[model samples]
Target: MVFLLLSLVLGVLVGILLPFHIPLVWGKYFSVALLAAIDSLLGAGKAVYEDRFDFWLFVSGFITNTFLAGLLTYAGDRLGVELYLAAIITFGVRIFQDLSILRVYLFKRFSTTGPQGVSKTRPETK
Candidate 1:
């Protein structure tokens, strides 16, 4: 997970340093693919937090989700339908759900209780 996040940061930095541009004609495919990738990444994070992360599951899901999203976007374009919206909506909802799960896990992990059942927190500054 840390490696993946580092790679993402490096890729973003490279993209920013380079001046390459994707043509506007491929916007729908690009958007859907990006969203699918994010969805897969978040799913992996959620799996890791749940202590059930699997390499094969993450890889297969990442590839399949990205490819299916692009395929759907292409079909929608060819058929004159805005089918990409479905993928976008699905991915968006999933991303939020994953984030929520992660957030809850973080809160529980960090907010441990004392022997008296008092929640642990930072001491107040004088």
Candidate 2:
């Protein structure tokens, strides 16, 4: 649950920073988004590695963002620097990714619950 929320917050931050060329954009949002994403990713990776470490996620985020930041830097267009848009894009991508992963798990579990072992008719009201 916390992971999902963190992903969403990070995505929002991503959106904020993505429009780096927009002069009037709020720097705070973008910065927060970037920080949140990195922090969340680090926490997750640390949990996976089971060592209370965060280097992996930090490295991965740094590597991915280097390319992303460079692309935005070169664009120099108002559209290219809009944080809101970037956040929306990030949120959409994460949501879809999670949904797809969930779909696979749900399908697998449902497939195993054959008709004979599962309830069919709805329960009667008391």
Candidate 3:
């Protein structure tokens, strides 16, 4: 987890420092790839929280998801159809579901708890 967090921060810093711009014509591919990346990142986060993270799985899944999404986008362009939406919808739903589960996990872990089962942040009632 420390490694993942550090890597993310480093990547953000490098991206900020480097000022790279993707071509406008590649926007569809970029969007799909971005969604795939977010999906993998969120999935990895949930897996880490659940104590089931696998480095190889995360790496392979990220590569595979991005490749497939970009391939579908390219194929749709060739066939005059919007096939990338499938990847978007699928990843989007998974992202939302993972976020929901993570939220529940976080709430259960941190909500209204204090020493000896008391809630430190809860207000006293009359």
Candidate 4:
């Protein structure tokens, strides 16, 4: 988890420092692919919280979702239909749902009572 956080921060820093651009025609594909990647990351985080994180599953899901989203966007452009919107909505909803679950898990994990059955109003002392 720490590694993942560090990598994310590094990626953001690099993105900010780099000069790159995606062509306008490929904007839909980029957006959908990014959404898919985010959804996969959130899903992986939730799985980790649930103690069910699988390396293979995360790898396959990340690749498949990203590829399919980009493919859908490309196909939609070819067919003159807004199919990429479907990918966007699906991934967006999944991302939000994953975040909600993670939030609840974290709250439950950290908001419990302390010793002697007393509710913890602040950080526990050593």
Candidate 5:
């Protein structure tokens, strides 16, 4: 319970802080993509193992991230920061955040598949 709450807080913090650094041109979309990658890599992997509220987890994360992003963007603008810079920063952080996830995705694709009859490949997390 504590861990889940902490994750939510962290996600919110990221969303809030992201717009301050990202450029406005592509901040929102990039942040959404970043959240998607982070959610897929961290959230989905666990969903495969834990039979719990996976649907709500993803939706909640999406909602919180977007809400925070918008709030922070508004705040940053009020603070006189360039919205474009903030958007760029958000996109940059988002891209950096997905590096490990992308690595694993690529590694899984290049490595091998599951049993001959199976179409899915399990992630090698170690």
Candidate 6:
């Protein structure tokens, strides 16, 4: 998680310092791919917070989701069917859901009361 955050910060800094632009024709693909990547990252964070993180799974999911979202956008362009909407909606919903879960997890872990009282209290220290 620390690595992920650090890399994200570094990547943003690099992107800011660099002036790069995607072709207008491929803008949809780029946007959908970005959304998918964000969803994957948030999902991975949620998994880690839940103690079910898997390195391989996170890597695979990040790559596959980004690729598939881009592919869907490309295919939609070819078919004139707007299938990218499906990818966008799916990833957007997942991102929000993952964020919600993470928020609850953090609040429960740090606060006196848990969400719906699901969080366990730490034993009193001697």
Question: lDDT per model, in order?
Answer: 0.86, 0.51, 0.86, 0.86, 0.57, 0.87
**Candidate 6 lDDT by residue in tens digits, 1-126:** 478789999999998888887789888898999999999989988887767789999999999999999998888889999999999999999999999988877777778766565675333345
Ranking by TM-score: 6, 4, 1, 3, 5, 2
RMSD of 3: 7.4
**Model 5 alpha-carbon drift over 4 Å, by segment:** 1-53, 82-91, 113-126
Give the TM-score comparing model 3 with the true structure, all chains together.
Answer: 0.78
How close to the true structure is residue 22 of candidate 2, measured as C-alpha lDDT? 42
After superposition on all C-alphas, the RMSD of every candidate to the true structure, in Å, is 7.0, 12.0, 7.4, 5.4, 12.2, 3.9
**Candidate number that wins on lDDT, 3 or 6:** 6
Candidate 1, residues 1-126, lDDT tens digits: the string is 479789989999998999888889987798899999999999998887766789999999999999999999999989999999999999999999999977776666577653344343323334
Worst 10 residues of 6 by lDDT: 117-126
Report residue 97 deviation for candidate 3 (angstroms). 0.4
TM-score per candidate: 0.81, 0.30, 0.78, 0.82, 0.41, 0.84
Better of 1 and 6 by TM-score: 6
> Whose lDDT is greatest here?
6
Stretches > 4 Å off in candidate 2 = 1-24, 27-58, 66-75, 78-91, 102-126
Candidate 3 residue-wise lDDT, 1-126, digit = tens: 579789989998997898788889999999999999999989987887777789999999999999999999999999989999999999999999999977766665576653455333223434
Better of 2 and 6 by lDDT: 6
Task: Report, for all candidates in order, the number of backbone clashes.
Answer: 0, 9, 0, 0, 13, 0
Candidate 4 residue pairs that clash: none
Model 6, runs deviating above 4 Å: 1-6, 115-126
Q: What tens-digit string does per-residue lDDT give for candidate 4 at 8-125?
A: 9999999888899788988878889999999999999898877778999999999999999999988988999989999999998999999998877666667665345434322454
In TM-score terms, candidate 5 sits at 0.41
Candidate number that wins on TM-score, 1 or 3: 1
Please provide the root mean square deviation of candidate 1 (C-alpha atoms, Å).
Answer: 7.0
